[model samples]
Target: MKIERVKSRVSLRRTIESGTEEQRRAVLEIISTVRARGDEALKSYTEKFDGVRLDSLRVTNEEIEAAYQNVSEEALRIIREAAENIRDYHERQKRESWIIAKEDGTMLGQKITPLDAVGLYVPGGTAAYPSSVLMNVIPAQVAGVKRIVITSPPNKNGTLPAGVLVAASELGVKEIYKVGGAQAIAALAYGTETIRPVDKIFGPGNIYVALAKREVFGQVAIDMIAGPSEIVVLADETANVNEIAADLLSQAEHDERASAILVTPSMKLALAVASEVKKQLETLPRKAIAVSALENYGAIYVTETLAEAVEVVNELAPEHLEVMTAEPMQLLGQIRHAGAIFLGRFSSEPVGDYFAGPNHVLPTNGTARFSSGLSVDEFVKKSSIIFYSEPALQRNAGKIAAFARLEGLEAHARAVEERFKK
Candidate 1:
């Protein structure tokens, strides 16, 4: 890795959205097929994509019990601990129904209601990421969602990953299914015989999953159309090169398109971190993926000062940012954009990925500039409440009718007038 020196922050840039037209077409076709054929479409696509044909799309209780036995006691304990942490953290975010009564005899309020049901999509293939399973489902549970269904691809043997099953079962989500890809998303959007349509879908996946979420936006709500994972580290000379390199690789190992960037004022620190990255990359099992990401998207920029480095981070708006300056908290106030921010040298990104209560499923591809990470709020809906006494209506009905008629909506004006007339 070669460190690049820049007098300004304008040059640090990378292409974030790289979804191809072919991917979109493929996802659309899968979604359409699933919409047309329901469960049969799911089984067909499972064999087509996952290379396995299942007798049933839903996982049975016997299978869940077997998954519990297959998992190690230690692993199960860790999952429970992480679940507790996530539950406790999200508990703070829960909202109650609030109402305000005015002296004029009018009442206004907001009702926060959880979705009737939610669908969680966990990826399968190379490895079983039980962590993703926990992250996606726990928040819905905290929000008081009644039915949480899980969908994950099965192996060639047509068995779902035991780890995924264990995680879902731990969270009281027993409605697990053996289906994946855009087809599962389609089934979730349009009800199948075995799998009912959910109020919203939550989770992350490959390009097909992201595109499917995009295609099915109007049919059902999706958490987000997440892109490749990304991380940006804003540090000073006090930052450790080894820690920085390790943090960058933590996200880089996610996939080839993932990004890991270092923005700092000291050229020496930048050069040292770049060298450390190259050295560390050689040892990682996912070396090929991380290397391609670094070659294409990774960079080390020597800014004029820490302030300029902060500006660069804001412009890029990375999914995860580690501020390792002299005063990390002081610099935090200046950070206007980021899905999650880690302070100090000890706060590496992986801690948040696995152990921390915060959801690791963050907005990617500079979307942090606008959106946020998945949270308990994502699993619920809000409805505005309003009430007016007869006297209050009499006082305001004429003004409301006048306003409605000015907009040329006669029905709205008449509705307001009738209230007073009654």
Candidate 2:
């Protein structure tokens, strides 16, 4: 990691990736084929990309039962506990349909309706993420979504990973399918013989999957087009150098493009953390990936004051921010943008990633400035409820007609006046 003095604003914003024209064209073809051919298209693409010919695309009950046997009891215990924590946290986010009744007999409120169905695409093979399964499914379940689907590519042996299956099973998610890639996304959006179309799609995937999501967005809602992971640690001289280095590397190891930064007012702390990061990088299993990330995107910024360090953090708007100063909580109000904030030495980033209740699927790159992490809100839709009594409409009819006519909407004005005409 390199060290520099902050002169002005610091920015970690990377250009949002729009897939190459070739990839975009390919994704379009896949989506069109799936919409036209349905089940046949899904199986053909599965055979071509996953290198397996499957007569059935859905995972049978027998396979899920066998997956339980493969997963160790200890892993199951941990997964169950994590699910409970996640469910408990998201349960608090649920909103009931609320209405306000006025003395004049006008009732106004909002109705909360859970999405009928949602599809989560878990990457297969080595990229499989059981943690993702927990993070995405629990929130939907908490929102009372009736149908939740899991889709993943089958391995050479034509079975999903045991951990992925186990995680889905633990959540009581029985709609697991043995398909992945852009085709899986297409199937989720458009539906096939074995799979039904969902109201929305959620999950992480490769470039092709992302493009497919973008293509199918109007047909079905999608989660954000996520970028690589990021973490920015705002620290001072009182912070521990070793802990800062370890926390930064935790995100760097995620992707070669992942950003890990340190902002502090202490020159000594900055230099020490830079050295510690190098020492720690030598032992990481994904050393090559982390090294590439640090070389390209990681840095240690020395600011003139702790307040200035906080300003730089706001400008960066990193996905994950760790405040490790004399009093971490004191800086909470100062932080305006961060997908997830880890305070003090004990609250490491991984705590939020796995064991902690918060959702780990966060806004990446610099999008934390405007967006938020995944939650129950994403699984439900809100509809405005309005009821106007005869007296209420009679009183407001003229004003409503005038307002609508102001916009040259004659039909709207007449629609409101139609009820009042003699």
Predicted model with the maximum TM-score: 2
Question: Which ten contiguous residues of candidate 1 have the minimum total lDDT?
Answer: 9-18
Whole-model lDDT, candidate 2? 0.92
Poorest stretch of ten by lDDT in candidate 2 = 121-130
lDDT of 2 by residue, 1-422 (tens): 89999954989998889989999999999989988999899889989999999999999988988989999999999989998888899999889999999988999999999999999999875566899999999999999899999999999989998889999988889899998989999999989888999999999888898899999999999998989889999999999888999999998998898999999999999999999999999899999999999999999999999999999999999889999999999999999999999999999999999888999999987899899999999999999999999999998999999999999999999999999788
Q: State the lDDT at 240 in candidate 1.
A: 85
TM-score of 1: 0.95
Q: lDDT winner among the candidates?
A: 2
TM-scores of all models?
A: 0.95, 0.98
lDDT of 1 by residue, 306-327 (tens): 8888888888888999998999
Q: What is the lDDT of residue 125 in candidate 1?
A: 73
